[model samples]
Target: MDAAVSLLRRAEAAIPSGRGASALFAMLRPDDDPQSWRSTLNNDGAPYQIAVTDAGADASVRLIVDPFRLGRDEADRVGRNLAAFDRIAHRCSSAAAARCRRFMAALAPSFEEGCERRSGDIWLAALPGAAGVGIYVTARGRAPQIQCTRLIAAAGLDHHRAAIAAIHAYGAVEAYSIQGSRCDDLAINIYWKPRGGTPLPPAINFEPPALSPGSPPTALARAPLGAMTLCSTFAVLGSGRGSKIDLCNHCLGLDLAASLEILGRFCDLSPAFVRGAGDMLAGEDAEIAFLGVRVRPSGDRAYLYLKPAASACQSVPHLVEGATCR
Candidate 1:
């Protein structure tokens, strides 16, 4: 049931734009024992239904996206891409750890194509072997003309493991971590610049603020490419049972995807739920208004600058003496 809901939400959030877009959801169950396995497909009024008898009593899902939403050519492209994914979705639903890695590697080519088209970021998730979940995030422009895949670990949120590595290696400017109260999880979001790329906003001279020994502030670092925050959350979902997806649409998708992928790594399939309402993916960039004064640009050796937020300045007295937001 949890898996079914997650995919439903993901389908709604996966696309870059929702205008004219519609999806058909279907689940398979044993006819003999319908009570043992049941499924739900909540469409917002459009008419669609499908039934199939398979041994997926645990769970089975198929999503039909309306090609009309993307127009003729693009629609055809997306349709082909989705068809490839559908072929493997069932196998992914029950693949093991080794199989998951292989699945990701095999799917890399398709994702690489998605990146090449580069209208928006492409993301997909699946439960490998009913124990863990896997999400693949493929973006372009960071490492232009090259396909680089990084393994991100959910447990390494504090140190900003993969996020930091991607930033430095790929010259990514926009990065941050969010610590949400609603969900016990961390969101390490990032935007990247291609290798040998020039600064987006010309340049300036500034320095990054030093964090206190204890907990750091919301705004993390500002670099030539952009600014990054490694936000920490107060909530912790132990065993991932009954976890709520109560966050903004963009973040909700990211948080749920990341958490599930990490949980799947541990092969821990506990009950989880997405409590809040949301939308399909919007073409617009995610709202990053919360990191006021934490991000600044510079043309220095670091290629970027950072400063403490007003709250951070007040909390850490040392930052106030020489800190400047300009």
Candidate 2:
């Protein structure tokens, strides 16, 4: 098995299930070729991500995975694999985790009944001791019916009126993550950019919003090209009165040379052979469609999103290869 997959399996076997966005890992079946799934796990176009945090023996890998496995046993396999993530580094045994699980279970029917077909936006967070699911709540397209707040409300998660109110205010955000293990932690993170209408291979475009007159020249103030989006991607920590900004920054997408410059400003990532780097390409010519990075007060964060291209197929059937929303 590849080291990354091996690490993933170890983590899977170590526990079961995952954190919100990044901690979603599961065991790979014997028949499975780990290499085949790398593309799916890394593709940013699909909102699926495999993010590695830290290094060496202590390194933790987190992923917000797509549940669309191809085989008949896929669900069973995924369930077993998904089970591996629950206790990777931390365990959530309190009533909150139970509530969180129930909330997610309650969310399934609404997701299925929805008329619109949006790419599944499974969210995983590597913030440690946090585990929960999130969904986009905004209305989309001609008479959209399903929204996150409605689903949450239907699931009875709206009892946290503060969270529901915050959702209404941040209607434009793309993603959200709820902190589960912390029981009392009722924080939600809203991804600033919006992605819909199937997988559109990324193109470089940095559309930064006009900053205030006194704004400084920093990532938080401006934006970078080919990054996720120019509009700021934000994190909402609490709801209503308790809510405050947790982390907010522009997620930049860049070429190798440009990636290095921004990378250094944030972390000490060596330009050569950096372990757990998101850029996964077997051949030298594989263009990095995205070198995703985040600039924040704690430090800069990076995600090796998007898969390396497969052999020149007419269409390799990956999200970046052009697929319509189903």
Candidate 3:
């Protein structure tokens, strides 16, 4: 707890302020519920991750804040979070910021507004300790594609229509990272699942993005990528962001050592320290479903995903790719 606080304070100057997500750093320490968090393994593999920005000096943290974990009603917390997001977004003056802000704002879940979001569909994050928040929206089917197209139009990303359109998978997660209203492009995480066993890297038909670390599932011979648990590979076209693809796996497995071994492939972070971070929250009865790793496309940055306890997120049904009627 002291260490996390110190780190947050050190990065405070670089980190932004004024969003519901902005409170995650502080809330995580004293009032923080360990049930919600992840450590992006850019440096040491600690449960709470903090990284310095590449573009600037801003401290960035990649994390997810589950409203339900804080012992508050989902609607009460999500409503406030979304409202806070808008308030912060409203202050974005730059065209880039405003356009990106509007795009993300559109993705907020609104059951009455036809937003197809389940209880666990909406997740929030701090983009490596930015001044803003990153809102993640999960879509189950094709209808949301049209919704995304409309959002693209609003976000002024119409030029990248073909780019976003090329993405295909069983389900996709669209993440709009708003750094206190400063946003760049859209990142769509597309994933597929096989009926049994770990999924093969080449099972899906498609080429990897340039400069990528090859396929994620096969990146490590030990724990190949498969949607067996909370895992998936995202496909993004360079159309919007000028051409870049990232392979990532956000998953929870029954085994810990295997997951750690897989995490070691992405960076030089100590396995003991990384495991300790997760250990900090582990309890005899506490469900340790928070065990997982995330891979970033750039330099293949890896993150240790952890949630102290599991939530009501319905298990995404196993995706059994049907035999192509060739």
Top lDDT prediction, candidate number: 3
Q: Candidate 3 on 127-182: residue-level lDDT in tens?
A: 43344444444444337466557545555554545444544223243433333334
* TM agreement with the true structure for every prediction: 0.19, 0.48, 0.50
Worst 10-residue stretch by lDDT in candidate 3?
Answer: 317-326
Q: Rate the local accuracy (lDDT) of all candidates.
A: 0.26, 0.35, 0.36
Tell me the lDDT of candidate 3: 0.36
Model 2, position 287: C-alpha lDDT score: 33
What's the C-alpha lDDT at position 204 in model 2?
Answer: 12
Residues 1-326, candidate 2, lDDT per residue (tens digit)? 22223233333343222223223343222233322432222332232334443332333434444443223343543343234333332445355555444444333323332213333323333423344433222233312124455445543444454444444343344333444454454444333333434332222122222222553435433553223431222222233222222112114334445544444444545333243343333233233433334443444444333222333222333334543211
Please tell me which model should have the higher TM-score, number 1 or number 3.
3
lDDT of 1 by residue, 126-218 (tens): 222222222233333344213223323332333334334444454533222112112333222333333435532211111233333543222
Q: Who is ahead in lDDT, 2 or 3?
A: 3
Best by TM-score, which number? 3
RMSD of 3: 10.3
Candidate 3 matches the true fold with a TM-score of: 0.50
Model 3, C-alpha of 204: deviation from truth (Å):
12
